[model samples]
Target: MRPVLLLLLGAHLAYAGKHSLKYIFTAVSGDIDFPEFTSVGLLDDGQFDYFDSNTMKAVPKTEWIRQNEGADYWTRATQNLIGTHQTFKVSIQTVKERFNHSTGVHTWQLMYGCELDDDGSTRGYHQYGYDGSDFVSLDKSSLTWTAANPQAVITKHKWEATTYAVKEKAYLENTCIEWLKKYVDYGKDTLERKVSPQVSLLQKSSSSPVTCHATGFYPSGVKISWQKNRHDHDEDVDLGETLLNEDGTFQKTSTLGVRPEEWKNNQFSCVVEHQGKTIRKTADDIITNFESVPIGIIVGAVAAVILLLVIGVAGYLVYQRKKGFKPVSGSDDGSNSSAHT
Candidate 1:
């Protein structure tokens, strides 16, 4: 009979262990917030029990039970939930409830308490951390969410900078090309052309002596002189000083002061001596039928005055003939006209 009683006691203890292992709090419908705690019944050894929602486990507080009120029932329930070795297994019902309702909630609280780090240190909260509060609501049907990383943002900025640099370089290159094209076009098309030199002469109507100024830019060397009927007289030819410009071009001018008679029936010319060839251009050649004083008009006016005087004398002689008048030498009487008739 004692052996049978011992067998029954062992069987009862084994059944009790199995029932204790299976006993776990199942979370039903409610808003499950993380890192919260609740009090459960005490264990038979009189210890306090606290349920943690973050770890989904129960923990026994033995020292707490000895120091606080309701130690007997609180300690027993805590021991039953935490087990003998102060370790608890997470309930599947709690895990399922947390997983199903974790669509937009913290899911790290579902981990068993034993799985937590023993150092009691938690990683700081960040956008990608497990305890991060910066989570977007997950679409339950699509099971998708959006996130951003700082590395990707930095890469995008670098790409934009590179593109701007390339564009600036291209703009500078195009501007240089345009400038070169303009320079080449100007150099090829713009140059001076040769033209015949122009000449002009001026004189005063009064007795003032004539003045002559000859000015021109001749690429070829030139000679300018005043001549009387193509004869060179002893006169001073005022040759102006030559000037050299920055562009390697030359200019020359000459002047002469002469009496008015010097231009009488005379031609003044500017002769260009270039490359063993002499080209003579005169001011007379430019002015058609140019003469000093118009001698023909003067002679014609004198002849007209003389002819008119002669005609008047002839008419007085004819009138004397018609009146039958005779003239006597040194006679003052009118009777001499009849004696001559």
Candidate 2:
């Protein structure tokens, strides 16, 4: 089916390193003075280096460029890029028809190399784009765009972009990914290796969702979910994004909705699956383990009581021994103590 088209594209493929592509579209309406425009790019590091589009060159000349740390790199990248400019003139008669001047710009970027472990496999890729100031994200199976502007304006020519993107993506996978593998063997700076994730539960709040959070994870492939009676439950669960932590680890949160009855009945648990093992923690566990300190205090009190009784018994035995002494005065005969004195 059309569900996944690229996976079926090739039987044998070559490799290539650091190859990519991009595109842009602009449309204007309303004022008699209006125009239509669009563009495409092949980029490095998210910036259009060694190349210039009409918008790229003009936007950065002002504060936007100077404030950008990568200004120098992209501006200089033109030397390595191929660029072209076209001018179209409309006679005075056609000017009245174009008005309102709606402009849209979209760009896509990609970077691919061989997996560090396997030459035949790809290290995967980093591919994303921008629709004007908003963001667009894509993967092997999906393409998405988000913006504050109305969806209508954004989707105006979405089909055109989609068709081009699909073709370009297939081109990269079948041609670019493997071709790069020839020259670009993943030695060190390749894809990140997988690491076992740390899993924890967030505190429960009244009327709020119960969250199971995993932090300091790796590979972005771990799973977190809810369980009832040791059984996994997926219904009514929401998974948040897996974001990178400051320490280069990944973190994500999954929320489970519970009815008032479930909380009162203690019917929920958080379970995390990482590295082929499952760790489960339940709300009832908190209540069962929270009083360990109190158990230690009771043991201490019994020890103190036993020590007091032993001391009292020792004191009584000493008094009895003293009372029995009767101070013998003479060496042998049963002489009176008064005579010896």
Candidate 3:
């Protein structure tokens, strides 16, 4: 029941801290486009290191890690990940057999992390999931395993019998927190930096929903809301997931669905809040794309024009050959095909 509660209430298991270090490993079986295994290391929810079955090498995702860590660090990390990869392969099979799953897509996930609060409070967790449901989790206080279902009992007993939980607890409390502190020191400038998002109001047409997109912000936390006639409007609004950008920043979008007549008669605004800064965009800021030609159509038109020009030139050559007129041969003209000659 504890594990089941953890499964249902994820992201609320512990209070969010000022910083966190997490390692997420996923192993998959059956046919899928994704890699068979992947391991990601995150510092404060931003990826700092990554490894996969395809790469078979642990590599830094952030420049700070790249600059701070050397080849020896990567080599050790890679070796550890290789062992983890093999273990995950076997673990997935073991879990599959336990669940009586013979085929199809099955995933065995392990998420373990330590959080450090600004007030010096700390929390650590190690959890496992099978097929997107909780299998078991470590109860650090009692040094026991909490199984979500009967199928996980065997694993729980087997793991408890050995010194696995002891080793894991040690690592989570000591080594994990140590590495987290070192990483925070390494990327303190980037991690603690607060960059305001570039907000934009967009719509494809009058009938389409108005979207407030905020991009290029650090720390990832943001709030987007809609206001009608200067009052908070929550109806017919959709909030999208915050996503990481390639440049290590974050982006988020919130869409408001309202009729054109309603928006025209009433004042509508999108308000974005990030890092203690509030930005509000009114209807005047909405950028409509319906009047603009699509890039595909523009490219096709350009290609069509170029193709017609080429065809016309080729046809003229054919017509000229058909007539009595002929150009002199290259050999007769005393010119070689080689430009240098």
Candidate 4:
């Protein structure tokens, strides 16, 4: 399992033709048993660098990055992260005071990055959050900051009075985008590689919903749907978000809720599409982990699955804050204003 602290920081999803690079800095205050300060850098939603107050050193998370960057790069990144760590520590206290939070698990985070589309267009963003809520963000075009809450208004005015927005805009539009492109080139083979997903059909019991799970996929572009009698079926379907695996692959699940009688009366199947290939599985392929288990043990098994799903959802929520890029056909310009837990 990934460190809970890292999950609290961010796990960002990747977008399909467009590539992105993001930096996430987190500071915490209270009795929470976690690193007080930590920094993470992601390339196309895959972590490339990470640093925490405990190690006090910046390290690469990918072999390609470690091989391409030298000692000087790590040293410079470490120094910059150390400075940001201290700044975040102070910022956390400032936010606690502003929110009247005296002693609890409070977090202050800053996320900023740039996105490059395959067509050569780019977009940039800089956002801050306090205790899992939006604080403020920079509007590059206007050279101003937008405050999400009243408490952020003070910081907004403070930044607008100085040349902070100008500097940030310059970095996001130029330096950040340049770095993103360079990093993408460094790992072109890995980042651009395509891998098909392994599909599975699962069910806890006959009464439980059937889950279609797909794992070991790359580029994070996949579609899982249900079919009834060779036609598309959408009713009573629960689609899950694509999640990152520790090995740099992705996984997703979609559950179909239908009575056993209804499923028996019709030919139901799960279909997964990725990388120009399709895989289909029918009810006959369902894997029941609870088979032959006692009633009490079966209940426990169900509870365990639910718990895991809850934890996955928590991580998904954290990752959702750092917006990803999109393909050329996508209309979203990789801009999001709100930051939620």
The candidate maximizing lDDT is 4
Write model 4 residue lDDT over 187-227, tens digit each, in one string. 88799788888777888887899999887788788999999
TM-score: which candidate is best? Answer: 4
Better of 1 and 3 by lDDT: 3
Q: List TM-scores for all candidates, in order.
A: 0.22, 0.40, 0.77, 0.80
How many residue pairs collide in each prediction? Answer: 13, 23, 0, 0
- Candidate 1 deviant stretches above 4 angstroms: 1-196, 202-220, 243-251, 265-341
Q: Global lDDT of each model? A: 0.27, 0.35, 0.66, 0.67
Give lDDT tens digits, candidate 3, residues 1-341: 11111011122223333777765667778887666877666666566777788878888878999898888888877777777778788888887987899988787766666766666666777777677666787787788888889988887887778766776666666666666666777888788778898887889887788988787788878999999999999999998756555456777789999999998899999999999999999999887883454443334335433422221222222322322211100000111111100
Better candidate by TM-score, 2 or 3:
3
Error of 2 at 122 (Å): 8.7
Segments of candidate 2 deviating more than 4 angstroms: 1-175, 178-184, 187-192, 245-248, 284-341
- Cα shift from native, residue 282, model 2 (Å): 2.4
Query: For all the candidates, what are their Cα RMSDs to the real structure?
Result: 62.8, 34.3, 21.1, 8.4
Scored by Cα lDDT, where does model 3 land? 0.66
Candidate 2, residue 302: how far the Cα is off, in Å: 51
**How do the residues 128-176 of candidate 2 rate in per-residue lDDT, one tens digit apiece?**
2122222222244453322223432333245236554454445435544
